[model samples]
Target: MTATPHLNTEHPKHNLTGFIIFLCSESVIFLAFFSGFALLKTAALNWLPPGVEGLEWRTPLLNTVVLISSSGTIWLAERCMSKGNLMGFRAFWLLTMALGAYFLYGQAVEWSGLQFGFTSGVFGGTFYLLTGFHGLHVATGVFLMGLMLVKSFIPQNYAGGEQGVQATSLFWHFVDVIWIILFVLLYVWQRS
Candidate 1:
Protein backbone atom coordinates (compact mmCIF):
# COMPACT_ATOMS: atom_id res chain seq x y z
CA MET A 1 0.00 0.00 0.00
CA THR A 2 1.32 3.43 -0.90
CA ALA A 3 1.07 6.27 1.59
CA THR A 4 -0.37 9.59 0.35
CA PRO A 5 1.70 12.70 1.03
CA HIS A 6 0.01 15.43 3.07
CA LEU A 7 -0.27 18.85 1.51
CA ASN A 8 -0.58 22.03 3.58
CA THR A 9 -3.74 23.78 2.45
CA GLU A 10 -3.52 26.79 4.75
CA HIS A 11 -2.31 30.14 3.46
CA PRO A 12 1.37 30.74 4.12
CA LYS A 13 2.42 33.76 6.17
CA HIS A 14 5.89 33.89 4.67
CA ASN A 15 4.61 35.09 1.30
CA LEU A 16 3.17 38.23 2.82
CA THR A 17 6.22 38.71 5.01
CA GLY A 18 8.51 38.41 2.03
CA PHE A 19 6.50 40.99 0.12
CA ILE A 20 6.65 43.41 3.08
CA ILE A 21 10.40 43.03 3.17
CA PHE A 22 10.57 43.77 -0.53
CA LEU A 23 8.54 46.92 -0.03
CA CYS A 24 10.87 48.04 2.74
CA SER A 25 13.85 47.66 0.42
CA GLU A 26 12.00 49.69 -2.20
CA SER A 27 11.29 52.35 0.42
CA VAL A 28 15.02 52.69 1.08
CA ILE A 29 15.70 53.34 -2.62
CA PHE A 30 13.03 56.06 -2.74
CA LEU A 31 14.37 57.62 0.46
CA ALA A 32 17.85 57.84 -1.03
CA PHE A 33 16.57 59.70 -4.09
CA PHE A 34 14.49 62.04 -1.94
CA SER A 35 17.49 62.80 0.26
CA GLY A 36 19.61 63.56 -2.80
CA PHE A 37 16.99 65.95 -4.14
CA ALA A 38 16.73 67.77 -0.80
CA LEU A 39 20.50 68.14 -0.55
CA LEU A 40 20.75 69.48 -4.09
CA LYS A 41 17.92 71.92 -3.55
CA THR A 42 19.58 73.35 -0.44
CA ALA A 43 23.07 73.63 -1.91
CA ALA A 44 22.27 75.09 -5.34
CA LEU A 45 21.43 78.76 -5.91
CA ASN A 46 19.40 77.99 -9.04
CA TRP A 47 17.04 75.07 -8.39
CA LEU A 48 15.25 75.07 -11.72
CA PRO A 49 17.26 74.87 -14.92
CA PRO A 50 17.93 78.10 -16.84
CA GLY A 51 15.04 78.04 -19.32
CA VAL A 52 12.52 76.42 -17.04
CA GLU A 53 10.45 78.55 -14.66
CA GLY A 54 8.64 76.35 -12.08
CA LEU A 55 6.60 73.18 -12.35
CA GLU A 56 2.99 73.75 -13.30
CA TRP A 57 0.53 72.68 -10.63
CA ARG A 58 -2.84 72.02 -12.23
CA THR A 59 -2.46 68.72 -14.13
CA PRO A 60 -0.22 67.08 -11.55
CA LEU A 61 -2.67 68.01 -8.79
CA LEU A 62 -5.45 66.38 -10.75
CA ASN A 63 -3.25 63.32 -11.27
CA THR A 64 -2.55 63.19 -7.55
CA VAL A 65 -6.28 63.17 -6.84
CA VAL A 66 -6.81 60.33 -9.27
CA LEU A 67 -3.90 58.28 -7.92
CA ILE A 68 -4.93 58.83 -4.30
CA SER A 69 -8.51 57.86 -5.09
CA SER A 70 -7.19 54.50 -6.34
CA SER A 71 -6.11 53.63 -2.82
CA GLY A 72 -9.73 53.85 -1.72
CA THR A 73 -10.98 51.81 -4.64
CA ILE A 74 -8.40 49.07 -4.08
CA TRP A 75 -9.32 49.01 -0.39
CA LEU A 76 -12.94 48.45 -1.32
CA ALA A 77 -11.91 45.67 -3.66
CA GLU A 78 -9.98 43.91 -0.94
CA ARG A 79 -12.91 44.24 1.43
CA CYS A 80 -15.26 42.78 -1.12
CA MET A 81 -12.88 39.90 -1.77
CA SER A 82 -12.65 39.03 1.94
CA LYS A 83 -16.43 38.86 2.12
CA GLY A 84 -16.58 36.53 -0.93
CA ASN A 85 -18.33 39.12 -3.09
CA LEU A 86 -16.62 38.47 -6.39
CA MET A 87 -18.65 40.90 -8.48
CA GLY A 88 -18.02 43.76 -6.11
CA PHE A 89 -14.36 42.86 -6.04
CA ARG A 90 -14.14 42.88 -9.82
CA ALA A 91 -15.87 46.26 -10.08
CA PHE A 92 -13.60 48.02 -7.62
CA TRP A 93 -10.50 46.30 -8.97
CA LEU A 94 -11.32 47.50 -12.47
CA LEU A 95 -11.81 51.01 -11.15
CA THR A 96 -8.44 50.92 -9.45
CA MET A 97 -6.71 49.87 -12.67
CA ALA A 98 -8.48 52.62 -14.59
CA LEU A 99 -7.37 55.23 -12.09
CA GLY A 100 -3.77 54.03 -12.31
CA ALA A 101 -3.84 54.20 -16.09
CA TYR A 102 -5.27 57.71 -16.00
CA PHE A 103 -2.51 58.87 -13.68
CA LEU A 104 0.15 57.42 -15.99
CA TYR A 105 -1.42 59.15 -19.00
CA GLY A 106 -1.48 62.45 -17.16
CA GLN A 107 2.16 62.07 -16.22
CA ALA A 108 3.21 61.33 -19.80
CA VAL A 109 1.31 64.36 -21.04
CA GLU A 110 2.97 66.58 -18.46
CA TRP A 111 6.39 65.22 -19.34
CA SER A 112 5.81 65.95 -23.00
CA GLY A 113 5.28 69.66 -22.33
CA LEU A 114 8.35 70.03 -20.11
CA GLN A 115 11.04 72.50 -21.24
CA PHE A 116 13.94 70.49 -19.84
CA GLY A 117 15.34 67.02 -20.46
CA PHE A 118 16.84 64.47 -18.07
CA THR A 119 20.34 65.67 -18.97
CA SER A 120 19.60 69.34 -18.17
CA GLY A 121 21.31 69.43 -14.74
CA VAL A 122 20.92 68.34 -11.13
CA PHE A 123 17.26 69.41 -10.98
CA GLY A 124 16.42 67.71 -14.24
CA GLY A 125 18.29 64.52 -13.41
CA THR A 126 16.69 64.24 -9.97
CA PHE A 127 13.25 65.15 -11.23
CA TYR A 128 13.19 62.50 -13.96
CA LEU A 129 14.88 59.88 -11.77
CA LEU A 130 12.34 60.26 -8.97
CA THR A 131 9.20 60.61 -11.06
CA GLY A 132 10.27 58.05 -13.63
CA PHE A 133 10.99 55.46 -10.97
CA HIS A 134 7.63 56.06 -9.33
CA GLY A 135 5.92 55.93 -12.69
CA LEU A 136 7.53 52.53 -13.32
CA HIS A 137 6.10 51.28 -10.05
CA VAL A 138 2.66 52.63 -10.98
CA ALA A 139 2.86 50.80 -14.28
CA THR A 140 3.85 47.60 -12.51
CA GLY A 141 0.97 47.86 -10.05
CA VAL A 142 -1.50 48.35 -12.89
CA PHE A 143 -0.13 45.31 -14.74
CA LEU A 144 -0.36 43.12 -11.66
CA MET A 145 -3.92 44.22 -11.05
CA GLY A 146 -4.73 43.33 -14.63
CA LEU A 147 -3.46 39.79 -14.06
CA MET A 148 -5.42 39.52 -10.82
CA LEU A 149 -8.60 40.63 -12.55
CA VAL A 150 -8.17 38.03 -15.26
CA LYS A 151 -7.58 35.24 -12.76
CA SER A 152 -10.65 36.31 -10.79
CA PHE A 153 -12.95 35.17 -13.54
CA ILE A 154 -12.56 31.56 -12.48
CA PRO A 155 -14.57 30.69 -9.37
CA GLN A 156 -11.99 28.31 -7.99
CA ASN A 157 -9.18 30.79 -8.57
CA TYR A 158 -11.03 33.40 -6.51
CA ALA A 159 -10.79 31.38 -3.28
CA GLY A 160 -7.12 30.60 -3.71
CA GLY A 161 -6.01 34.06 -4.83
CA GLU A 162 -6.79 36.18 -1.81
CA GLN A 163 -3.12 36.56 -0.89
CA GLY A 164 -2.33 37.82 -4.40
CA VAL A 165 -5.10 40.39 -4.18
CA GLN A 166 -3.86 41.56 -0.80
CA ALA A 167 -0.27 41.81 -2.01
CA THR A 168 -1.31 43.78 -5.08
CA SER A 169 -3.43 46.08 -2.94
CA LEU A 170 -0.53 46.68 -0.59
CA PHE A 171 1.76 47.45 -3.53
CA TRP A 172 -0.81 49.79 -5.03
CA HIS A 173 -1.17 51.61 -1.72
CA PHE A 174 2.60 51.96 -1.50
CA VAL A 175 2.70 53.43 -4.99
CA ASP A 176 -0.02 55.91 -4.10
CA VAL A 177 1.73 56.97 -0.90
CA ILE A 178 5.02 57.43 -2.77
CA TRP A 179 3.25 59.59 -5.34
CA ILE A 180 1.81 61.84 -2.63
CA ILE A 181 5.32 62.47 -1.33
CA LEU A 182 6.73 62.97 -4.83
CA PHE A 183 3.93 65.36 -5.79
CA VAL A 184 4.63 67.50 -2.76
CA LEU A 185 8.39 67.41 -3.32
CA LEU A 186 8.53 67.85 -7.08
CA TYR A 187 5.58 70.19 -7.59
CA VAL A 188 4.66 71.99 -4.39
CA TRP A 189 7.94 72.35 -2.48
CA GLN A 190 9.91 73.43 -5.55
CA ARG A 191 7.68 76.44 -6.05
CA SER A 192 8.21 77.80 -2.56
Candidate 2:
Protein backbone atom coordinates (compact mmCIF):
# COMPACT_ATOMS: atom_id res chain seq x y z
CA MET A 1 0.00 0.00 0.00
CA THR A 2 1.19 3.52 -0.72
CA ALA A 3 2.05 5.67 2.28
CA THR A 4 -0.68 8.05 3.32
CA PRO A 5 -0.04 11.75 2.93
CA HIS A 6 0.38 13.70 6.15
CA LEU A 7 -2.71 15.57 7.15
CA ASN A 8 -2.64 19.17 8.32
CA THR A 9 -3.89 19.07 11.88
CA GLU A 10 -3.04 22.60 12.94
CA HIS A 11 -5.92 25.08 12.78
CA PRO A 12 -6.53 28.58 14.01
CA LYS A 13 -8.19 28.84 17.39
CA HIS A 14 -10.47 31.61 16.09
CA ASN A 15 -11.30 33.31 12.80
CA LEU A 16 -10.91 36.78 14.27
CA THR A 17 -9.06 38.10 11.22
CA GLY A 18 -11.73 36.97 8.77
CA PHE A 19 -14.40 38.29 11.09
CA ILE A 20 -12.64 41.66 11.23
CA ILE A 21 -12.55 41.85 7.46
CA PHE A 22 -16.28 41.17 7.42
CA LEU A 23 -16.77 43.97 9.94
CA CYS A 24 -14.80 46.30 7.71
CA SER A 25 -17.14 45.59 4.83
CA GLU A 26 -20.11 46.25 7.10
CA SER A 27 -18.47 49.51 8.16
CA VAL A 28 -18.42 50.65 4.55
CA ILE A 29 -22.20 50.28 4.27
CA PHE A 30 -22.78 52.16 7.51
CA LEU A 31 -20.33 54.88 6.46
CA ALA A 32 -22.28 55.43 3.26
CA PHE A 33 -25.48 55.91 5.24
CA PHE A 34 -23.85 58.26 7.70
CA SER A 35 -22.34 60.31 4.86
CA GLY A 36 -25.74 60.65 3.25
CA PHE A 37 -27.23 61.83 6.52
CA ALA A 38 -24.50 64.44 6.96
CA LEU A 39 -25.01 65.73 3.45
CA LEU A 40 -28.76 66.06 3.90
CA LYS A 41 -28.32 67.73 7.25
CA THR A 42 -25.98 70.34 5.80
CA ALA A 43 -27.91 71.04 2.60
CA ALA A 44 -31.47 71.14 3.92
CA LEU A 45 -32.69 74.49 5.25
CA ASN A 46 -35.19 72.83 7.57
CA TRP A 47 -33.54 69.69 8.91
CA LEU A 48 -36.62 68.82 10.90
CA PRO A 49 -39.77 68.43 8.88
CA PRO A 50 -42.43 71.15 9.42
CA GLY A 51 -44.10 70.98 12.84
CA VAL A 52 -41.56 68.40 14.04
CA GLU A 53 -39.44 69.96 16.79
CA GLY A 54 -36.88 67.14 17.22
CA LEU A 55 -36.47 63.72 18.78
CA GLU A 56 -36.66 63.26 22.52
CA TRP A 57 -33.38 62.01 23.95
CA ARG A 58 -34.54 60.44 27.19
CA THR A 59 -35.64 57.00 25.96
CA PRO A 60 -32.90 56.64 23.41
CA LEU A 61 -30.25 57.63 25.93
CA LEU A 62 -31.49 54.96 28.30
CA ASN A 63 -31.46 52.42 25.51
CA THR A 64 -27.95 53.49 24.59
CA VAL A 65 -26.80 52.82 28.09
CA VAL A 66 -28.36 49.36 28.00
CA LEU A 67 -26.90 48.52 24.58
CA ILE A 68 -23.43 49.80 25.49
CA SER A 69 -23.48 47.83 28.72
CA SER A 70 -24.00 44.70 26.64
CA SER A 71 -20.54 45.19 25.18
CA GLY A 72 -19.06 44.92 28.64
CA THR A 73 -21.13 41.88 29.54
CA ILE A 74 -20.13 40.13 26.32
CA TRP A 75 -16.48 40.97 26.95
CA LEU A 76 -16.78 39.45 30.36
CA ALA A 77 -18.31 36.35 28.82
CA GLU A 78 -15.39 36.05 26.44
CA ARG A 79 -12.97 36.45 29.31
CA CYS A 80 -14.73 33.74 31.27
CA MET A 81 -14.68 31.39 28.30
CA SER A 82 -10.95 31.93 27.83
CA LYS A 83 -10.40 31.01 31.46
CA GLY A 84 -12.44 27.77 31.24
CA ASN A 85 -15.23 29.15 33.36
CA LEU A 86 -18.23 27.80 31.49
CA MET A 87 -20.72 28.82 34.14
CA GLY A 88 -19.47 32.37 34.15
CA PHE A 89 -19.57 32.43 30.39
CA ARG A 90 -23.16 31.26 30.29
CA ALA A 91 -24.27 33.74 32.93
CA PHE A 92 -22.68 36.74 31.24
CA TRP A 93 -23.73 35.59 27.80
CA LEU A 94 -27.35 35.35 28.87
CA LEU A 95 -27.13 38.73 30.50
CA THR A 96 -25.75 40.19 27.28
CA MET A 97 -28.66 38.73 25.31
CA ALA A 98 -31.12 40.14 27.82
CA LEU A 99 -29.64 43.60 27.47
CA GLY A 100 -29.84 43.43 23.69
CA ALA A 101 -33.47 42.39 23.89
CA TYR A 102 -34.22 45.25 26.23
CA PHE A 103 -32.69 47.71 23.79
CA LEU A 104 -34.83 46.33 21.00
CA TYR A 105 -37.92 46.65 23.13
CA GLY A 106 -37.03 50.23 23.97
CA GLN A 107 -36.53 51.02 20.32
CA ALA A 108 -39.89 49.55 19.48
CA VAL A 109 -41.55 51.65 22.13
CA GLU A 110 -39.86 54.78 20.85
CA TRP A 111 -40.78 54.01 17.27
CA SER A 112 -44.38 53.47 18.25
CA GLY A 113 -44.57 56.89 19.80
CA LEU A 114 -42.99 58.72 16.88
CA GLN A 115 -45.16 61.35 15.17
CA PHE A 116 -43.72 60.55 11.78
CA GLY A 117 -43.49 57.73 9.27
CA PHE A 118 -41.03 56.57 6.64
CA THR A 119 -42.78 58.68 3.96
CA SER A 120 -42.85 61.84 6.08
CA GLY A 121 -39.76 63.32 4.40
CA VAL A 122 -35.98 63.05 4.36
CA PHE A 123 -35.73 63.35 8.12
CA GLY A 124 -38.19 60.57 8.76
CA GLY A 125 -36.83 58.36 5.99
CA THR A 126 -33.25 58.58 7.21
CA PHE A 127 -34.25 58.21 10.83
CA TYR A 128 -36.17 55.00 10.25
CA LEU A 129 -33.63 53.61 7.79
CA LEU A 130 -30.65 54.05 10.09
CA THR A 131 -32.25 53.01 13.36
CA GLY A 132 -34.20 50.16 11.81
CA PHE A 133 -31.09 48.77 10.13
CA HIS A 134 -29.13 48.92 13.35
CA GLY A 135 -32.02 47.38 15.28
CA LEU A 136 -32.02 44.45 12.87
CA HIS A 137 -28.35 43.86 13.61
CA VAL A 138 -29.02 43.92 17.34
CA ALA A 139 -31.80 41.37 16.89
CA THR A 140 -29.42 39.17 14.93
CA GLY A 141 -26.81 39.38 17.66
CA VAL A 142 -29.31 38.32 20.26
CA PHE A 143 -30.38 35.35 18.14
CA LEU A 144 -26.79 34.24 17.66
CA MET A 145 -26.12 34.52 21.37
CA GLY A 146 -29.17 32.37 22.03
CA LEU A 147 -27.78 29.70 19.75
CA MET A 148 -24.42 29.84 21.46
CA LEU A 149 -26.08 29.50 24.83
CA VAL A 150 -27.89 26.38 23.67
CA LYS A 151 -24.68 24.97 22.28
CA SER A 152 -22.90 25.62 25.54
CA PHE A 153 -25.02 22.92 27.12
CA ILE A 154 -22.99 20.36 25.20
CA PRO A 155 -19.63 19.74 26.88
CA GLN A 156 -17.92 18.90 23.56
CA ASN A 157 -18.92 22.25 22.12
CA TYR A 158 -17.71 24.03 25.21
CA ALA A 159 -14.27 22.45 24.87
CA GLY A 160 -13.77 23.14 21.15
CA GLY A 161 -16.00 26.01 20.06
CA GLU A 162 -13.78 28.97 20.74
CA GLN A 163 -13.99 30.16 17.14
CA GLY A 164 -17.76 30.47 17.21
CA VAL A 165 -17.64 32.16 20.58
CA GLN A 166 -15.01 34.63 19.46
CA ALA A 167 -16.80 35.41 16.21
CA THR A 168 -20.07 36.09 18.01
CA SER A 169 -18.31 38.33 20.50
CA LEU A 170 -16.66 40.26 17.69
CA PHE A 171 -19.96 40.73 15.89
CA TRP A 172 -21.69 41.86 19.08
CA HIS A 173 -18.94 44.36 19.82
CA PHE A 174 -19.10 45.75 16.27
CA VAL A 175 -22.83 46.27 16.59
CA ASP A 176 -22.36 48.13 19.87
CA VAL A 177 -19.74 50.42 18.38
CA ILE A 178 -21.94 51.18 15.39
CA TRP A 179 -24.82 52.06 17.70
CA ILE A 180 -22.59 54.54 19.52
CA ILE A 181 -21.86 56.29 16.26
CA LEU A 182 -25.49 56.21 15.21
CA PHE A 183 -26.61 57.56 18.57
CA VAL A 184 -24.25 60.49 18.17
CA LEU A 185 -25.30 61.20 14.62
CA LEU A 186 -29.03 60.68 14.91
CA TYR A 187 -29.61 61.96 18.43
CA VAL A 188 -26.92 64.26 19.78
CA TRP A 189 -25.47 65.89 16.67
CA GLN A 190 -28.79 66.37 14.93
CA ARG A 191 -30.35 67.98 18.00
CA SER A 192 -27.43 70.35 18.32
Candidate 3:
Protein backbone atom coordinates (compact mmCIF):
# COMPACT_ATOMS: atom_id res chain seq x y z
CA MET A 1 0.00 0.00 0.00
CA THR A 2 1.21 3.48 -0.91
CA ALA A 3 1.30 6.02 1.88
CA THR A 4 -0.19 9.48 1.28
CA PRO A 5 1.25 12.48 3.07
CA HIS A 6 -1.13 14.66 5.06
CA LEU A 7 -1.30 18.36 4.27
CA ASN A 8 -0.09 20.86 6.83
CA THR A 9 -1.86 24.16 7.54
CA GLU A 10 -2.51 25.97 4.30
CA HIS A 11 0.04 28.68 3.64
CA PRO A 12 -1.65 31.71 2.09
CA LYS A 13 -1.05 32.03 -1.66
CA HIS A 14 -2.73 35.46 -1.72
CA ASN A 15 0.36 37.20 -0.45
CA LEU A 16 2.07 36.94 -3.84
CA THR A 17 -1.01 38.16 -5.61
CA GLY A 18 -1.36 41.16 -3.33
CA PHE A 19 2.29 42.08 -3.82
CA ILE A 20 1.91 41.89 -7.61
CA ILE A 21 -1.06 44.27 -7.48
CA PHE A 22 0.96 46.67 -5.34
CA LEU A 23 3.84 46.51 -7.83
CA CYS A 24 1.52 47.31 -10.73
CA SER A 25 0.19 50.39 -8.91
CA GLU A 26 3.70 51.54 -8.10
CA SER A 27 4.63 51.03 -11.78
CA VAL A 28 2.04 53.58 -12.78
CA ILE A 29 3.53 56.14 -10.41
CA PHE A 30 7.03 55.62 -11.82
CA LEU A 31 5.74 55.69 -15.39
CA ALA A 32 4.10 59.05 -14.86
CA PHE A 33 7.31 60.59 -13.54
CA PHE A 34 9.34 59.04 -16.35
CA SER A 35 7.00 60.33 -19.04
CA GLY A 36 6.86 63.78 -17.47
CA PHE A 37 10.63 63.95 -17.26
CA ALA A 38 10.98 62.99 -20.92
CA LEU A 39 8.46 65.62 -22.00
CA LEU A 40 10.12 68.30 -19.90
CA LYS A 41 13.57 67.45 -21.23
CA THR A 42 12.41 67.70 -24.83
CA ALA A 43 10.68 71.06 -24.30
CA ALA A 44 13.45 72.73 -22.37
CA LEU A 45 16.00 75.02 -24.02
CA ASN A 46 18.75 73.40 -21.96
CA TRP A 47 18.44 70.06 -20.19
CA LEU A 48 21.54 70.51 -18.05
CA PRO A 49 20.54 74.04 -17.06
CA PRO A 50 22.73 76.63 -15.32
CA GLY A 51 24.91 75.85 -12.31
CA VAL A 52 24.58 72.12 -13.05
CA GLU A 53 27.18 71.68 -15.77
CA GLY A 54 27.99 68.07 -14.90
CA LEU A 55 27.11 65.68 -12.14
CA GLU A 56 30.02 63.86 -10.55
CA TRP A 57 29.17 60.57 -12.15
CA ARG A 58 31.97 58.36 -10.80
CA THR A 59 30.63 58.18 -7.27
CA PRO A 60 27.13 57.28 -8.39
CA LEU A 61 28.56 54.64 -10.69
CA LEU A 62 30.39 53.05 -7.77
CA ASN A 63 27.27 53.26 -5.68
CA THR A 64 25.40 51.58 -8.51
CA VAL A 65 27.83 48.65 -8.23
CA VAL A 66 27.18 48.41 -4.52
CA LEU A 67 23.41 48.57 -4.91
CA ILE A 68 23.32 46.08 -7.76
CA SER A 69 25.54 43.73 -5.79
CA SER A 70 22.99 43.72 -2.98
CA SER A 71 20.53 42.13 -5.37
CA GLY A 72 22.94 39.22 -5.82
CA THR A 73 23.55 38.94 -2.09
CA ILE A 74 19.83 38.82 -1.42
CA TRP A 75 19.44 36.08 -4.01
CA LEU A 76 22.10 34.04 -2.21
CA ALA A 77 20.33 34.68 1.07
CA GLU A 78 17.12 33.30 -0.34
CA ARG A 79 18.98 30.27 -1.60
CA CYS A 80 20.38 29.73 1.86
CA MET A 81 16.92 29.91 3.37
CA SER A 82 15.65 27.35 0.89
CA LYS A 83 18.46 25.02 1.91
CA GLY A 84 17.58 25.48 5.63
CA ASN A 85 20.88 27.17 6.38
CA LEU A 86 19.91 29.95 8.73
CA MET A 87 23.47 31.06 9.41
CA GLY A 88 24.24 31.47 5.73
CA PHE A 89 20.92 33.23 5.21
CA ARG A 90 21.53 35.75 7.94
CA ALA A 91 25.08 36.51 6.86
CA PHE A 92 24.15 37.18 3.24
CA TRP A 93 21.04 39.12 4.24
CA LEU A 94 22.98 41.34 6.61
CA LEU A 95 25.56 41.96 3.89
CA THR A 96 22.75 43.07 1.58
CA MET A 97 21.56 45.58 4.15
CA ALA A 98 25.04 46.95 4.65
CA LEU A 99 25.49 47.45 0.90
CA GLY A 100 22.16 49.27 0.77
CA ALA A 101 23.32 51.61 3.53
CA TYR A 102 26.57 52.29 1.68
CA PHE A 103 24.65 53.17 -1.48
CA LEU A 104 22.45 55.64 0.40
CA TYR A 105 25.48 57.18 2.04
CA GLY A 106 27.14 57.60 -1.36
CA GLN A 107 24.04 59.33 -2.65
CA ALA A 108 24.08 61.76 0.25
CA VAL A 109 27.74 62.49 -0.27
CA GLU A 110 27.21 63.14 -3.98
CA TRP A 111 24.21 65.39 -3.33
CA SER A 112 26.16 67.41 -0.79
CA GLY A 113 28.90 68.10 -3.34
CA LEU A 114 26.48 69.26 -6.04
CA GLN A 115 26.00 73.02 -6.58
CA PHE A 116 22.34 73.15 -7.60
CA GLY A 117 19.25 73.71 -5.47
CA PHE A 118 15.82 72.11 -5.92
CA THR A 119 14.57 75.39 -7.41
CA SER A 120 17.54 75.83 -9.73
CA GLY A 121 15.45 74.90 -12.79
CA VAL A 122 13.62 72.04 -14.47
CA PHE A 123 16.71 69.86 -14.59
CA GLY A 124 17.44 70.22 -10.92
CA GLY A 125 13.80 69.83 -10.02
CA THR A 126 13.29 66.62 -11.99
CA PHE A 127 16.66 65.24 -10.92
CA TYR A 128 15.81 65.52 -7.27
CA LEU A 129 12.18 64.46 -7.64
CA LEU A 130 12.89 61.29 -9.58
CA THR A 131 15.97 60.20 -7.62
CA GLY A 132 14.39 61.23 -4.32
CA PHE A 133 11.36 59.02 -4.86
CA HIS A 134 13.59 56.12 -5.83
CA GLY A 135 15.73 56.68 -2.75
CA LEU A 136 12.62 56.58 -0.61
CA HIS A 137 11.75 53.20 -2.11
CA VAL A 138 15.26 51.89 -1.40
CA ALA A 139 14.99 53.07 2.18
CA THR A 140 11.66 51.34 2.59
CA GLY A 141 13.09 48.13 1.12
CA VAL A 142 16.04 48.23 3.51
CA PHE A 143 13.73 48.78 6.45
CA LEU A 144 11.56 45.86 5.38
CA MET A 145 14.65 43.66 5.03
CA GLY A 146 15.78 44.69 8.49
CA LEU A 147 12.46 43.52 9.93
CA MET A 148 12.74 40.23 8.08
CA LEU A 149 16.28 39.81 9.35
CA VAL A 150 15.09 40.21 12.91
CA LYS A 151 12.19 37.79 12.40
CA SER A 152 14.52 35.24 10.84
CA PHE A 153 16.39 34.74 14.10
CA ILE A 154 13.20 33.36 15.66
CA PRO A 155 12.97 29.59 15.16
CA GLN A 156 9.24 29.66 14.44
CA ASN A 157 9.29 32.63 12.08
CA TYR A 158 11.65 30.97 9.62
CA ALA A 159 10.28 27.44 9.84
CA GLY A 160 7.87 28.04 7.00
CA GLY A 161 8.66 29.22 3.47
CA GLU A 162 10.58 32.47 3.05
CA GLN A 163 7.64 34.60 1.98
CA GLY A 164 8.91 37.76 3.62
CA VAL A 165 12.37 37.35 2.17
CA GLN A 166 10.93 36.66 -1.27
CA ALA A 167 8.75 39.76 -1.19
CA THR A 168 11.58 41.99 -0.01
CA SER A 169 13.85 40.54 -2.67
CA LEU A 170 11.36 41.40 -5.40
CA PHE A 171 11.05 44.93 -4.10
CA TRP A 172 14.80 45.40 -3.81
CA HIS A 173 15.39 44.11 -7.33
CA PHE A 174 12.76 46.49 -8.66
CA VAL A 175 14.44 49.40 -6.94
CA ASP A 176 17.82 48.46 -8.39
CA VAL A 177 16.39 48.12 -11.89
CA ILE A 178 14.84 51.57 -11.63
CA TRP A 179 18.17 53.03 -10.55
CA ILE A 180 19.87 51.56 -13.64
CA ILE A 181 17.35 53.31 -15.88
CA LEU A 182 17.80 56.56 -14.02
CA PHE A 183 21.58 56.27 -14.17
CA VAL A 184 21.48 55.85 -17.93
CA LEU A 185 19.06 58.71 -18.49
CA LEU A 186 20.49 61.11 -15.92
CA TYR A 187 24.19 60.42 -16.29
CA VAL A 188 25.15 58.59 -19.46
CA TRP A 189 22.69 60.03 -21.97
CA GLN A 190 22.87 63.47 -20.43
CA ARG A 191 26.65 63.43 -20.79
CA SER A 192 26.39 62.72 -24.50
The lDDT values for all models are 0.91, 0.91, 0.87
TM-scores vs. true structure, each candidate:
0.92, 0.90, 0.91
Q: What is candidate 2's lDDT per residue for 24-89, written digit by digit as tens?
A: 999999999999999988888778887888999999999999988999999999999999999999
Clashing pairs in 3: none
Sorted on TM-score, best first, the list reads 1, 3, 2
Question: Which digits, one per residue and each the tens of the lDDT, describe model 1 over residues 98-131?
Answer: 9999999999999999999999999889989999
lDDT of 3: 0.87
- Distance from true location, Cα of 71 in model 2, Å: 0.6
lDDT of 3 by residue, 85-146 (tens): 99999999999999998988998898888898787888889889988999999899989999
Which stretches of model 1 miss by more than 4 angstroms?
1-12
Cα displacement (Å) at residue 12, model 2: 6.8
